[model samples]
Target: MKQFWDFGMEQAKSCIFPVVIFLSLAITKVIHLSLIARYDLILIICLVTQVLMVVTKRETWDEVKVICVFHLIGLALELYKTHMGSWAYPEEAWTKISGVPLYSGFMYASVASYMCQAWRRFDITLGNWPSTWVVCALSAGIYFNFYTDHFIYDFRWVLKVATLIIFHRTVVYFTVNDRTYKMPVALSFVLIGFFIWVAENIATFFSAWQYPNQEQGWHLVGIGKMSSWLLLVIVSFMIVATLKHVKGKMKQAPKLKTEKTSF
Candidate 1:
């Protein structure tokens, strides 16, 4: 127990900056800030964490660089939309402003990238295929972007979602890594996704959180949660396929088995 506690303490040391900054901000104010200001903490931590990550894991820099760039690209795209006022962060995090919070977008991605890699490594070393599936599934599902209240008339997000669903898979098929689009990963992503849906319904119903565009026919638990999830699965597979093709790895593709396995 003492050894366990010591290891935890070391882990905490690694996250000191993020922990302190986020806690201070959380205490100072959670809502009411403009999007940019609200996310100042996030931005600060991301920059700091990125620095620390390089300092500690100098060897894995190549792998880190890939995801970091991918994530940053996504952030830039979001920034463009936010700047155009196509979508606004109506809920202020205790600061006053309109665009999406800066820290939220950038830092969250940093943390998520690290977490997914850690989770992936963990699975590869011990749990074999199941662990990898869990990591990929959960990561992809969250990024699937279905619950974005796509029907919200404010930004025509619904239209964007529709357009993406129709065309995004093609983009993914050309962009993401090849070893990614498979049944184990897809199923894991699907199950966790439904779990999240179930959780969100509970939250919305209880008023713990609000879904502003609940009136949309796609909300499932609002309109089409299942359909949205299906779209997500397709996109994730496409992303993996595209990535594989880009690396000239599609020539020898492995089949994704959907059969039930006995543990």
Candidate 2:
């Protein structure tokens, strides 16, 4: 019971920033800020929060860089998706560019932020990670599918199969209050994806963005989006793993399993 409690608390601590940001965005819609639009306010809050994380050492500089990568990657997708009519921001703001508020990218960055913070806070490690090239290629393929699927045959299922093959043996390890815990890496992605889907519903409810069908009124985002989020989680995880998980000559070791972080 104590272990479960501690684990839950640790999860909550790791989730603080994302949860707070989402709820604050939802709540901010109710408050009228005279000079600034709600979307602009969100952007300001996100930037300040990111700076504060580094200022207080809640996140390291490397982690911040990883988060920035997520931001840019996400913004690129947002630009394309918005152009393709995937979804849209209904409100007007000075930060809007091609119908996407700059702050929207932070939603993706928040996931990386959570992952990095959770990794350090929980002394997380990985085992049986697939080859760097294979994982990187899979990440790239998944990302490409997000755009190319609209124009040609969707290869998401094929990519999903490839991911399963590569990650079949991968496991994530972490410590919670001195007792070690482990989970299949794929399962973690699915769990996180589901929660992100839930958050998406909430974001839409608060008018963060709307789909074609949602223009009339808010409705649940299709269940299919969870699959997309799962793939995205993999991409985000791989990028951060490249920075934090890969280190030194451990790459040369055969069957690299245990992490070197002296946990």
Candidate 3:
């Protein structure tokens, strides 16, 4: 049906950046290049794709900026995680900083790119959105928890509960074939997190990065990562929402009197 085809097209459009990155990783594995060389190729591919997205008008300048910001944020986390022995790049690369590859940042950037494209392509909008300050506070807490969990208790469950409460009434509206559809904001976050977990498995299978266990050989990434991904999705969502100016309602200032007030 036309509706089905339209839905598929919208989804594909949103996924274009992620698909390209994964395919590049696959090709890198097949070619059996050196670790540094593979990372170099991936970095080049990501840069080219970003340029092309802008040149082709597939992404606006603002969207590109948001994606770049995601890269920085992701790279910061990568540096800390790699340093803490959370995971590692098994090969050497000139672009590496403390065992983390520069290309690794693009992996996070791809998520932001997908979100930006999906928002525009699907005509997505948010309703009953939670206060931006509340979301930001939760996001910051979740991010810090990633680093603090080793030294202290992880309140991931508490954060998750708070996330649900904040987003419980929020709805995401999108269009397919000119017909609008709606879904719960929390459900969408969980779904995206699930898919990102699946992709993480595939990325690890290709040896993009290795866990402590995967140092010997490939294996499935732990299911527990889904919770982390869920938190990250919220972070990414907040960034995109801020950029797109879809944070609940925008209040217009009241009009002033046309004539000047008497002294």
Model 1 C-alpha lDDT per residue in residues 205-247, reported as the tens digit of each score = 4322234464232243643555554444344433443443455
Which lDDT tens digits does candidate 3 get at residues 1-263? 78678778888888889999999999988986644488878889989998999999999897888898999999999999989999999876678777898999999999999998888887787777777788778888988888899899988999899888888987777766656667778889999999999999999998889999998789888899999999999889977776566543323222223323111
Poorest stretch of ten by lDDT in candidate 1 = 171-180
User: Candidate 1: misplaced stretches above 4 Å?
Assistant: 1-36, 76-87, 90-98, 107-116, 123-183, 192-263
- lDDT, candidate 3, equals 0.84
Task: Give the root-mean-square deviation of each candidate in angstroms.
Answer: 10.9, 3.9, 8.5
Model 2 regions more than 4 Å off: 248-263
TM-score of each: 0.43, 0.92, 0.91
Q: What lDDT is reached at residue 33 by model 3?
A: 64
- For candidate 1, the TM-score is 0.43
Which 10 residues in a row give candidate 2 its minimum summed lDDT? Answer: 248-257
User: Global CA lDDT of candidate 1, please?
Assistant: 0.41
